[model samples]
Target: MNFYDFKFVFYLAISWCNLLEVDGITVAEQLKDVLMEGYDSSIRPVNNERDILIINISMNTMSVLTLDPAEETINFSSEFILQWKDEFLFWNKSDYNITWLKLKESFLWTPDTTVSTSIDTNYLIDASERYVSVKHDGTVRQSIYAVFTNLCDMNVDKFPYDQQTCMIKMGPWSYTTQEVTCIVGRDIAPNDTDFGDFHGNSEWDFEGIVSSVGETEDPDVNFTFSEVHFALTVKRRPQFYVWVLLIPTYIITVVCIFGLFTPTANHGLREERVNLGITTLLSSAVILQIVANAMPKTSELPLLGNFILAEIFVVAIGVLFAVLVLTLHQRAHTREWRPPAWMLWILRMTGSSKFLSRNITKIRHKSSTAERIHYTGEGAYLFKNLDESLQSVREYIQEEDRDYFRELTYVKFFDRLDFLLLFIFQVGNALVTLFLVKQ
Candidate 1:
C-alpha cells in the first residue's frame, strides 16, 4: 500500500504542474529563443550580405544653450529620430500575442551615426537610457537625446545684429555608402514644436532649419559614406549689447563734447577739456576690452569696435584743439596785442563777432575800418626814428596801432575759436555715429 500509493501521487502532482497556464515571461522566452537564434549585431540585419540598408533619420532641436564667438562653437540640445528595418528581429504577432517589443538598444543592432562637426574628437550620442522599439513588421525605431557641441560659421561684422549658421553632419562612422545610406527625412520636421515649455536660445533666436543628404569621402580610408546635414540659422538678440555696451559709450562721447565747450573761466578749457578727454578715453578703453573679450581675434574691425574707436578719436581731437584755443587766449597777456586783419574779417564773416565779444557791439569794432592796420610795439618804436618829413605819417600809423589792438583782442580770437570748434566737433560726432550705423 505504501510504495504504489506514493508513486501514483507523485505522477499526479507532475501532471498538474505541466497543465498550468503559460504567462508573459513564458511568451517572451519563446520569442527570444526563436528571434535571437543566430542574431549577429556586427553584420547588417539582412538575409543577403550585399544588400544596402537605408536608415531614415531626423533631428529636432529642443533648445540652444550658448554660442561662443571667441571659441567659434555652439551648443544645442536635440533629439535624433532614427528608423530602420531589421529582418532578423521580425516575428508573427499572433504567435506571441504582442504587436511590438521594447528592448534595450544594447541588445539590438543600432546605426553608428557620427557627428562629423563635433568639437569633441571622441563625441558620442549616448543612448544608455533609451530603448529600441521593434514592431511586428520588422521595423525598428529609436530616439536618442544628445547635446551637440559643434563648429559654427559666425559673422560678427554686425555683432549685435548678426546671424550665424552651423552645420551638423551625421553619417555611418565605419560603413561606406555601398554598405549603408542615411536619408534626411524632409517631411519629418514636425518634432520641433515649442510645446510651451521650450526654452529658446538665451542670447539668440532660433531662425530656421534646413536639411539635405549627400555623400562624403573619408580622406584616410578613401571610403565614400552617406551623410545627412542639418543647417541651423540663428539671429542674435541685441538688447544686452545695446543697453550695456553701446549706449554708455555714446553718452560718454556726447558729454565729453559738451564739456569741451565749458567757459574757460575757472580751470581754463585746456586743463578741463584734456582731463575730460582722458577720462573718456580710459572709459572707452575699458568698454573696448569688454567687447574684445567677447569677440574672436580678427584683422578687420567690427562695427561696434569702429564706433568706439571713432569716439576716442573725436575726444582726442577736442582735447588737442582745446589746447590750441587756450594758447590763443594767452596772446592777450597785456591787452595790447592785436589780431591780424584776416582774423577780424573771419569773425565778422561768420556772424560770430557779437558772440565772441560777450555783448552786441564791442567785437571787431575798428577805429576807421579802412582795411585795418598792422603794427607791433617794435614797429611803433622804429617809426619814431624815421625822418621829420614823415613824422605826421608815422604818428598817424602809431595811433592806428592802438585801434588794431582795441578792435580785435586775443581774447576775441580765443572766443571765436571756441564757437567754431564746438560746431565742428558736434557735426563730426554726428557724422561718425551715422556712418558706423549705416555701414
Candidate 2:
C-alpha cells in the first residue's frame, strides 16, 4: 500500500507541476511580445542609434514644411497624434500676420532622430498637418520665380502663387535667388499684400534661389539652413524691347524734327545750320543702330526706330526746301527787292559768323547794285534832247524819287511776313513732333 500510494501521488504532483510550467511559459511569451511592440513604438533605430520618437506633418500642394534640427526628417511608418500651437502667440505681432494659416494644418513630433527619405517633385505637400518652430535668433528667407516663354508678355496676375513655393530655374533642377529677407513681402512671399514696382525683362524668364544656405562666416554659429521655392509661367509675346528701346528712340526723333524750320530766304543763312541738323539725325541713327545691335535681329522694325528714320528724312527734305527758297529769293530779288524777313532771321540765326556774312555780302551785291553804284560816280547826271529833253528830264526826276518811297514800303512788308511764317513753321514743327514722340 505504501509503494503504490507513493507512486500515484508522485505522478499526480509531477503532472500538476508540468501543467503549471506550461501556463507560466505561455504568460512569459505574451509579455515578451507586448514588450517588443512597446519598444518599437517608443524607440527608433536611426543611424545605428536606438530609442527615438518620430514626428509627422502634412502640407499643401505647394507648401513648405521645415523640420527642426532636433527632430530631423519624418518617419513614414509611425503613428502621430494631432498637435497645435496657440495661434495668438504667433500671429499677435504688432506687424501684420497671417493667422488663418494656423487653423488649416497640424504638426507631430516626438524627439525622434530623422531617417533619410526620398521626396518626389510631383508629390504635393500635405497641408492638413505641418510642423513649425520659433527658435531664438531664427531667420528664414523665401524667393519665388515664374518661368515663362517670354517675360515681356507676363503680367502681374500671372505671377507665382507662393514665393515660398515658386522657384527660379538655374540648372536642370536648380535656381538662384532674386531676394532674401526674414519678413514676407511682395518680392519674397506670395501672401504679401504690397507689391513693389516690378519690371519684367523677357530675357529673364527663369528665376529661383538656393535651397540650402551657405555656411556662415562667423565661427560662433556653426550651422546654417535654408529652403527655397520656385514657380514658372508661360507667356504670349515679347514686351521688354518696346519699353527699353522704342520709347527712348521716339523721343529723340521728335527733337531731330525741329531742325526743319530754318528758312532759306535769309541773307544771314549758312551751311552749318543744315549740317548741325544732319549731325543730330546721324547721331539718332547711331543710337538706333546701338539699340538694334542689342536686340535679336528681325525683319520687323521697332516703332521708335521707324520714327527716328522718318525724322531724319524730314530734316533732309527741309534742307532741300531751304536750298530752293534761297534760289527763288535770289531770282525774285533781282527783278524786285529784299528777301523775306523770316528768311533774314534764319540767315542771321544760322550764319552769324564771318564766313556767312562775307558770302551773303558778296552774293547780294555782285551785279546790279555794285555796278549801278560804280557807274553813278556819286554825281547827278543830266541828259539833253533840246527843249523837250530839258522839260522831260525835270518831270522824270521828280517821278523817280516819288516811286522809290512806295517800292521800299512794299519790299519791307513782304520780307516781314515771309520771316514770320518761316519762324512759325519751324517752331510749330518742333512742338508737334515733341508731343507725338512723348505719346
Candidate 3:
C-alpha cells in the first residue's frame, strides 16, 4: 500500500507541473495577439493631433539610365531607405527574446510619400522586395529599390556645352506638412563615394548631388506640403558633337568662302562655285536640323543655333558675291556703253586711280606724238585741211582711248570689289565664330 501510493502521488505531481507549463506557454502567445488585436495599419503612430509623423529619407543613386532632352526626362536607378518611429510597435526585447523583427511592408505602417516627378508610362523600371524592420525602440526602417524616370526641365540655351540640373522630388501625396514632415536620413551624404559605380549613361558626366527641403502650398489639396529634393548636377560631354556636327559645319562654311575665288569668266567654273555655295548652305541646314532634333523644343534659340545661322549668312554672302562678279563681267562685254561717272569715281576711290591715270597719260602722249609727226611730214597740205582733218583724227583717237580705258576699268573694278568683299567676309566670319564658338 505504501509503495503504490508513493508512485501514484509522484505521477500526479508531474502531471500538474506539465499543465502549468502549457498554460504559461499559452499566456506568452496571447501577449503578441493582444498587442496586435486593436492595431490599425492605416493610422499614424502618434498619440496627439499636434504630433508630427517625421520620416527620415536617404537615397543612393545606382546609375544614371538616360537623359533625353527631347523628352524632357531623366531616367535613373536608386536605393531609398526610409525610417520612422512607430510608437505602437514598441516592445520589451527581453520579454520576446528578440532584438529585431523583419516584416513585410503590408504588416506595418509607412509614409504616404511618393516621387512627384515620376513619368506616367513607366513609373518604375525595376523594384526590389519591400522590407520593413522593427527595432526594440519601435523604429521602423524600410529599404526600397526602384528605377525612376523623373521630369527634368532643360535649359538648352547653351546646348551641347550645357550643364543640367535634374531633380528627384518626393513628398506625401495626401498629407499636409502639419501632419507629416520629411527630414534627411542619418546618412546625409547619399551616393557620395559611389559615383564611379554609375554606368548607364555615356553622354552625360555626373557632376555632383545636392539635397534640400522645400515647402509649397497646394490649392487643390488645400494644404501646404513639404518636399525633399535630390538635385543631380550633370554636364554634357560635347566631344561627340564637336567632331560630328561642329567640325563638319565649319568645314562647309570655309569651303563656301573659298568658292568665291573661282573664276567667273568660265561658265563651268562659275556654276561649280555656285553649286558649292548651295551645297554648303544645305549641309549647314542639315546640321542645324540634327542639332535641333537632339535638343528640347524651346522658344529661345541655342548658341549652336546662332552659330549655324551665322555660317549660313556667310555662305549666302559668298553666293551673292559670285553672282555680282558674273554680272559685272557680262556688263563689261558691252563695248558701246561707258560706266557712269559716279561708278568710275567709286572704282578710283577703291585703289584703281593710279592705274587709270597711268593708262590715260600713255594714250595722251601717243596722240600728241602722232599729230606732231603728221604735221611735220605735210606742212603745206596739213595747213589747207588742218581744222576739219585734225578734228576728225582727234575725235577718232579719243573714242579709241575711251573704249580701252572703259574695258580696263571694268576689269579693275570687278577685281577690287571681289577682294574687298572676300576680306570683309573673312573678318566677319572670324569675329562671329570667336563670339559664338569660343564663348
Best by lDDT: 1
Q: Determine which window of 10 residues in candidate 3 has minimal summed lDDT.
A: 358-367
lDDT by residue for model 1 over 1-439, one digit each (tens)? 6999999999997775454325534556667667777787777787888999999988644467889999999888777778999988888797677788887787778888878898763224556656788898889998777777889876798877888878888888888888889888662232346421233466887776678998888798788999899887788888898899888888898888878866444224367677888898899999888888889898766778888888889988888887766665654443434455587786664443333332222323234546434446856656544533264565566556645554454445565656777788989898898888677
Per-residue lDDT of candidate 2, residues 249-336 (tens digit): 5554445434333333243453454665677667767866765554334455444445555555656665665455445545444544
* Residue 107 in candidate 2, Cα distance off native in Å: 27
lDDT by residue (1-439, candidate 3, tens digit) is: 6999999999997886576457466433444464567888888888787899898877754577789999999988877778888888777876665666776677566787788888742325232346578787889887666777889999988777888988878878878889899887432333456433433368887776677787778788578988888887778888898888777877778767866753233423565677788888888888889888888879877888878888999898789878766765675564333445576665555454433342332323233654454433547675747655666688678867766765676666666565666677878888888888876
TM-score of each: 0.77, 0.33, 0.73
After superposition, candidate 1 runs with Cα above 4 Å error: 1-29, 121-129, 187-199, 263-269, 332-346, 349-413
Model 1: colliding residue pairs: none
Q: Kindly provide the TM-score of model 3 when superposed on the true structure, using C-alpha atoms.
A: 0.73
- For TM-score, candidate 2 versus 3, the one ahead is 3
How much RMSD separates candidate 3 from the native structure? Answer: 8.9
Instruction: Report the C-alpha displacement of residue 254, candidate 1, in angstroms.
Output: 0.6
For model 2, the run of ten residues with the poorest summed lDDT: 172-181
Top candidate on TM-score is 1
